[model samples]
Every structure is written in structure tokens, then in C-alpha cells.
Target chain A: MRERSDDTLETPITSMIDIVFLLIIFFVVTAQVDKDVVDESITLAQAKNAPAIDAVDPRSVTINLNKDGKINVALQPMSISQLQQLLLAMRTQAGSAIPVLIRCDYETQFRHIDRVMQAAASTGLYRVRLIAEATGG
Target chain B: MRRKPPEQLNVPMSSMIDIVFLLLIYFIVTAREEVTEAHLAVNLPAPGVAKASENKPQMMEIEVHPGYLSVRGMRLPIQEIANTLVRLGKNDPDITVLVKVNLSARAEDLVTALDLCSAANLNNLNVVTLK
Candidate 1:
């Protein structure tokens, strides 16, 4: 018969601590902290060579154009005038050099987008970017 | 002096704790999530090396709907579309072509319009969707 010895029993505290540290490192490395302001209902064109954009800057504003030709800012529908007003307010908040990013659907009209651009230009917003997919991966 | 066994030696956990804390801080500082912005869904071809120039006003506009193709709202035939693009390209090498296609427009229709633009060697093409 084999005799069990209490002296041989060892608490796995050190191993448990090591496992906790590993978990922390794993989460730290794999966590996705950046999330898009706009919803996925808006399908953006895929460009294999699109320039890498900086998302940490709070000065960038995203405007979405739906398939129905409706304009929405962060999922809230707004008129051109309203959009202009909101953009102007954002410009003021961002202190003069605000970057406006417009993401429109593939079926949106030029005139509609042009009007939005015109509004941004008139508001004295200089950094206007028309987002497009870079071709040919 | 008597020597102790190697397995009985204690590891200095303080240093390891400091490392863990430093790692935690480093992750906290650099762990910002990537923000994805809205965009159009299209495959753009790789652009060859060309001299950059100031953007100019758009001269030619091509509209693509489900069954018809129009140039500046004027309905035109497929053969004429390519011809017009070639003529316009010859007139102004810096010409800006605005391509507006409806959402429900067929992929073939969009491709045909793009093909016409390609045949004309028009590089400054701006594609917009008709909402």
C-alpha cells in the first residue's frame, strides 16, 4: 500500500499567479480598443491600397450616406442645412482646422455629395477628405 | 559552512511584479482600438507612377443607371459613350470625369462605364453614388 505524505502536497499559488500574468498579457496584446463611430449599415468600398488613416484624432467627423440617398451623421438622419450646421459647430469645437471625412454609398449622387463638400468649404473647413478604396492589392 | 539544495532557493518575485506592472502600464498606454470609418466598396486598380498635379474642375460626367448610361443626364449609346470619352480625353488631358452610378445599377453597366473611361486613358476619375 502506498502512503500519502502531507509534506509532498504543494499549493499551486505560484503557477496560478503565472497563469494570471499570461492571461493579462494575452488580453493586452489581442484587445481591439478602436471602434468605428458609424454603424455597419453603411457599406464602404474596399480599396486594397487605401492609405492608412489615423483614428485617434478626435477632429475627424464621419458622415454616412445611405442607399436611399439619405444623409446621416452617426446614424442620425439630417438635412443638408442641419448637416452644415452640425459641421460648423464641430469646426468651431475643433478650433478652425477640422478634418471632415465623408463616407458615401456607391449609389449616392454627385450633386448631393458636392453640396456637402460645398457646405464644408463654405464653413472654412480646409481639410476635406473624400474617402475612397485604393485599387489593386 | 553547509550548502543548501538548489530546489530550495526562493525566486525574487518583487522584480517580476515590477515587470508585470510595467507591462500593464505599457499596454494601457498603447492599447487604443483602431477606428474604422465609413467608405465606398469598390476595387481600385493600382495606379502607375505619374506626376501629381493640382486637382481641377470636373468636365465630363457619366451617369450609370440599371439599363441606361448617360453623359451629364443626356442619354447616349454605348458606342458613343466610349467615343465621347476619347474625344474629351484628347481635348484636356487633365480633364476630371465624374462617374455617378445608381445603387441598383448592374455591375456590368458600371464596368462598361469604367471600361470606356479606361479606353480613353482618363486617370482623374471621381466616382460618386446617386442616393
Candidate 2:
């Protein structure tokens, strides 16, 4: 009787490992580590009419503008002229149609955003995207 | 009484699987919670180039202030701006909405203005810094 109970207590290791491996694969694919890194410090504006971006362009440059008139590109703070030079280099590499996404803080002033816009315009990037929160604040 | 089972030499798969499951759960819980974000597409006027449209459309100038917005010299609250745009858009589909953002205006105010324009289906939008 004890032997039968011990046999039943043995865990099905092979099947458990199989399920674990499958779950790992699912997570790995869904995580999408290649997607653009979002800055946690920026508080984006909430807009109801804004269109949802299903898939962000991998080549697009994300510019984060904080409330203090500071600009962050890839988590590194940069000046307006530096931003312009970076944008120009990107345009030269990816052509004028290269996308630009501006992630401006909700409390930031318009003048700071204007500077970023001017920089993009100088680089021949006509159309740019302004990011907003998906839901109401 | 059952005889003691002979010890078999093999890898400890059960404990390893237990550790793997723990790690997976930890990752699933500690992963960054990404806040879904949307975007509003804007067109910036290229420098040194004039608009080539043969027939210029009627333009509505809207100024964004600190807490309110002024539409064509008439000051209006943020909530009422959408209705005004809708009424104007219905009158003329080709009307261009020119947004002059004040230096003191918050970015949220500009976004609210643009959102209202979009809600009114006013596609021809031009935003410039108010001098």
C-alpha cells in the first residue's frame, strides 16, 4: 500500500517541463524587447481623439521633453542644437520621411515644444507625432 | 512492509523544474507595466517654402492661453472650443485651423486644443508659436 502511494506521489516532470518551456516561449515573444523604451518620468497629456498607434516604427526617433525645458533622447539629455544635429543625421540616413515622435510632459510649456518642432523642421522632417496617454487622466 | 527502493543515479529534474517555475513567476510579476500611449500626427511647415494651394481656404485663428483659449479674438473656455470648431467645420470643410500657442501655455493645453480640432474632423491644422 505504501509503495502504491509513493508511486502516485511522483510528479510528471516531463510534461511540467514541456508546459514551462512553452510558457517561456510565449512570454519571450510577447515581451518584444526590441520595442522603443518608454521613459517613466514623463507624464503625457491625455487626449480622447488621438489615434492609437498599433505598431510604432522602429526607425522613428523618440524625443522626450520634460517640464523644465530639458530634452531626452534615448534617456540621455541633449540640447536643442544637439537634437537638430541628431535629427539631420537621421534624415541623411533614413531620408526626409523618417518619423519623429515627441513625448512631451503634460506640464511642459509650448515654447519648449516649439524648439523641438523647429529642430525637426530644420532637418526636413515635416510630419511628426506627438504622443499622449491612451486613456483619460 | 515494502522493501526500501534502490537509489538510482539520475539528474534532479524535479527540483530544477521547481526553480524554473519560481523564476518564471517572478519575471511575470516584476515585469514593467507599460502604459499604452496614443499619438496625434502633426504637419510642420517646411522652412523657406510657401503653400502652393491655388485657392487659399478660409483660416480660423485660435490662440491657446494659460487656462482658456481664444477663437478668432473671442475668448472661450476649453470645453466650449470643440463645439465652436464643429460649427465652423460644418460651415466650410476646407477651413484651415491655425493654432497659435502662447509661450506661457502648457503643453496639455495645446494637446487639448489639437484633440478638439481632431474631434471636429478639422484635418487642415497648422500650429505655430505665438509671437
Candidate 3:
């Protein structure tokens, strides 16, 4: 009878090692976090019930409102009319299912945020999220 | 002649595989799918959502100014907001606070006032637009 080779019992690790390396690369690529639009000088208002978003909707627009009531998108300051136009465009492009996240500075007047909300509402963007800092327990 | 005794082969990948698995576990434990971005989600008063009714919601007006917050014509400091709202909310649970702020007022002041309404458990609110 032919003798069995010693290598017959050994399991190969090359495939699993390659898979793990690929997984590490995938995570590293996806973990690059973009800086949020809120300015460092501005303080965030406290809220008792504010919570981190749950199951972030893929179709979401984040607009930043500074203390000056200026709305900034991707670091470019925009007028209220411009913002309205943008919201109207987004609403038409993505449909009403998209949720809008407004990150207004804590010191920003409510009117600015309200104007944005009104614009969003006018464009049929009713679903909204107002970003704020969590208050102390 | 008797065949030479088989030589012992060292497994080169055992330790490397163990290290890779440890790293995999570490990444799996540390990775978060969603970042912690705090927010308050609300649905605006949609035309379809608001039905025509004679019994409209009781509305309360609160004007946000640069130096003070005016609730029902009484101007007060920002700190006095919660107490007043709690009292008003107690008087009428269904009171909807409508906030009208000057363009110059800071967002912090507005939110601080709004926080009062939230503290008083007043869910129906409208932060009126400037324009």
C-alpha cells in the first residue's frame, strides 16, 4: 500500500490571511470620517431628549446655520433664496422620502432655522432633524 | 534500505493567522456603523396632515429678541423661560407655542427658550420664519 503524505493533514492559511487583509483594507477605507459643518467657535444648544440618529437615511441633506443666520452647504455660504432653490431641487430629485438634518449653531436665532424649515416645508421636505448637543443628566 | 524518517515541517502561518484574527476582532469591536450626531427629528405641519377643523390647536406666541424673550407680552430673561413655560403648559396642556424671533437674535437664545417648551412637555410648537 502507498504511504500517505505528511502534508495531507495540514490546513492552508493563505486564503484566510488574504481575506483578513482585504477586510482590514475595506474598513480602513470606509472609516474616513468627514468633518462636520458646525464651526468650532460656535457652541451647541443643550437638549434633554436629543439623540444620535438611528438608521441614518441614505437620502438626507445636512444644512449648517451659523449665528449670523447664514446657511452653509459644503462650506459655501448661501442666501435664503438660494437655500430654498437648493431644497426645492433636492426635493424634486430625491422625492419626499428624504429626511433633512439641520445643524444650526446654538447661538443662531430660531428664525434662521425656522426660515430653513419653512423653506424645506414649502418644498415638501417635511421630515426634518434639528441637531443639538445632549444636555447633562 | 529503510526509508529515511520523515522530517518535521514547521507551520509558518500559524502565528501570523493568530495575529490577523486578533486584529480582526479588535476592528470588529471598535468599529461603529453610525457616528454619534445628536439631533431632534420632527415632521413639519404638512397640508395633508393638518385637517380642517373648527377646534384649532390653542396657540401661544413667544417672540425671541436680542436681549430678552417675550411670552404673551411679558419680556423676561432667558433663564426664566423654563419656569414660565412649565406654568403655562400646566395651565393649558394643549397650548402650542409659536416662536417669532428677530433676525439678529442668536440661535442659542432661541434653542434655550425652545428647550423650555420641551421641558414643559409641550410637543406642538412653531418657530416662525423671519421672511
Candidate 4:
């Protein structure tokens, strides 16, 4: 009778390591995309009933409104007109279905958010989303 | 004669695989899928555009004050606003809810009002800035 070789007992792990590396790379890439569009400095409001968006449109614009009513898009601070222009440009490219996500500090006055919404409305991009903390924080 | 183990098997990948799995778990936990952030969707009226419907819907306006919320000039606390909105929504789910947010009112106040509106399943919501 032929003896079983020890080499045959070793599991083929090379493919598993490859798969793990791919998964890690995928997660790393997706985790990073939000950093550029979402400003970490702004503290979002807390809400109990807002629906969670499962898939955010790629063409969606994220606007950060600070307590002082300043507007930041992609981390670059801009005036309301500048925001209008950006929305117009996006509207031209994305054809008016462009979703606008607003992230504002809890203490930020409503006027700031209103201005952002008005800017979006004027640009014919009326799909506005107000971002809030889901945990009621 | 006993066969010797191959020298090529000296570098075991089990330890490396363990570290890779740890990294994968870290990334999985840290990945911000934006699920932590809830969203309230609003469809704003396009500028210079009028509603096509001939019938004007009954609009319920809620003003966000610094300390409390107001419905049709009646003052109510933030916690109590939800009950009023829920009652209105019960009457008509399509009732237009106009949130008139005071310029000095904190964003949290407006959010709370909208939260209540959403909770009531009020679909027609319009946010207008107070003059």
C-alpha cells in the first residue's frame, strides 16, 4: 500500500489569501470615497424618523453648512452664488435629477440650510436630502 | 529511508493569513456605508414653476421658534409639535406641510419639526425661509 504524502494534507490557501486581499482593497476604496465628499468638521443633526438611503446616487452633491452659515462642498468653502453655479453645472451634466445632500451642524441656524435648499431649488435640482444622525444624537 | 520534508514549505502563510483577516475585519467595521446618516428627502418647487393642479391643497404651516414651535400662530413645545402634525396628517396625508424656520432658530429645531412631519407620514412637505 502506498503511504499518503504529507504535502497532500496541506490546504490550498493561496486562493483564500488572494480573495482576502481583494476584499480588503474593495473596503479600503469604498471607505475613502466618503471622506472627500463629506466634511468631518460639521456635526449633523439628530432625527428619529428619517429614512436611511441604501444607495446614494453617484452624481449626488453633498453640501456642508456650518453653524456660521458658511457653505462647503467637497471641503471647499464657497458662496451661495458659487454653489448655484456648481449646481447649475451639475444640472447641465446630470440633467436635473441630481440629488443634493445637506449636512449641517446641530446649532446651525435654519437660515443657512434654507439658503442651501433655495440655491438647489433655483438651479432646478429639487431633490434635496437633509442628513441627520440616525441614533438620535 | 525516510523522505525529508521539502525546504520550500519553510515559509508558512498561516500567520500572514491571520494578520490579513484582522485587517479585513478592521476595514469591514470602519467602512462608512453612510448608513449611520439618515436622510429626509424634500422635493422643492422649481423656481418660476406653478403647480399644475387646479385645486389648491390645504397647507399646514409650522413655524420653528427659538424655544418652541408654532402651528397657525399657536405656540407648542418641540415635543408637542409631533402630536399636532400627526393629527393633521391623519386628516390628510397629502396636506402640504410648510416648515417656516426662523432664521435664528437652531437647525436642530427644524430637523425635529421635519422628523415629526416624516413620522406622521406627511409626504407633501415644503420648507420655506421666513422673511
Runs of candidate 3 exceeding 4 Å displacement: A1-9, A33-43, A49-59, A66-86, A89-98, A109-115, B1-38, B41-57, B129-131
Each model's iRMS: 10.9, 5.0, 4.5, 3.9
Error of 3 at A107 (Å): 3.8
Query: Which runs of model 1 end up more than 4 angstroms from their true locations?
Result: A1-33, A45-59, A69-82, A90-99, A107-118, A121-137, B1-58, B61-68, B72-91, B96-131
lDDT top scorer: 2
Error (Å) of candidate 4 at residue B104 is 0.9
Q: Could you give the CAPRI-style class of model 4?
A: medium
TM-score of chain A of each: 0.64, 0.73, 0.66, 0.71
**Pairs of residues clashing in candidate 3:** A106-B108, A107-B106, A107-B107, A107-B108, A108-B106, A108-B107, A109-B106, A109-B107
Give the candidate order by descending TM-score: 2, 4, 3, 1
Q: How many residue pairs clash per model?
A: 20, 0, 8, 0
Off by over 4 Å in 2: A1-36, B1-17, B48-55, B91-94
Residues A1-137, candidate 4: write the lDDT tens digits. Answer: 23457546665566666787789778778767756677777787888886765667787888989989999999899999999999999899989777888889988987678788888988887778888888643
Q: Provide DockQ values for all models, in the order shown.
A: 0.07, 0.46, 0.45, 0.52
Of the candidates shown, which would achieve the greatest DockQ relative to the real structure? 4
**TM-score against native, each model:** 0.45, 0.77, 0.66, 0.76
- By DockQ, the better pick of 2 and 3 is 2
Alpha-carbon deviation at A106 in model 3, angstroms: 2.4
> Could you tell which candidate, 1 or 4, scores higher by lDDT?
4
- Candidate 1's TM-score reads 0.45
Give the 10-residue window scoring lowest on summed lDDT in candidate 3 chain A.
A32-41
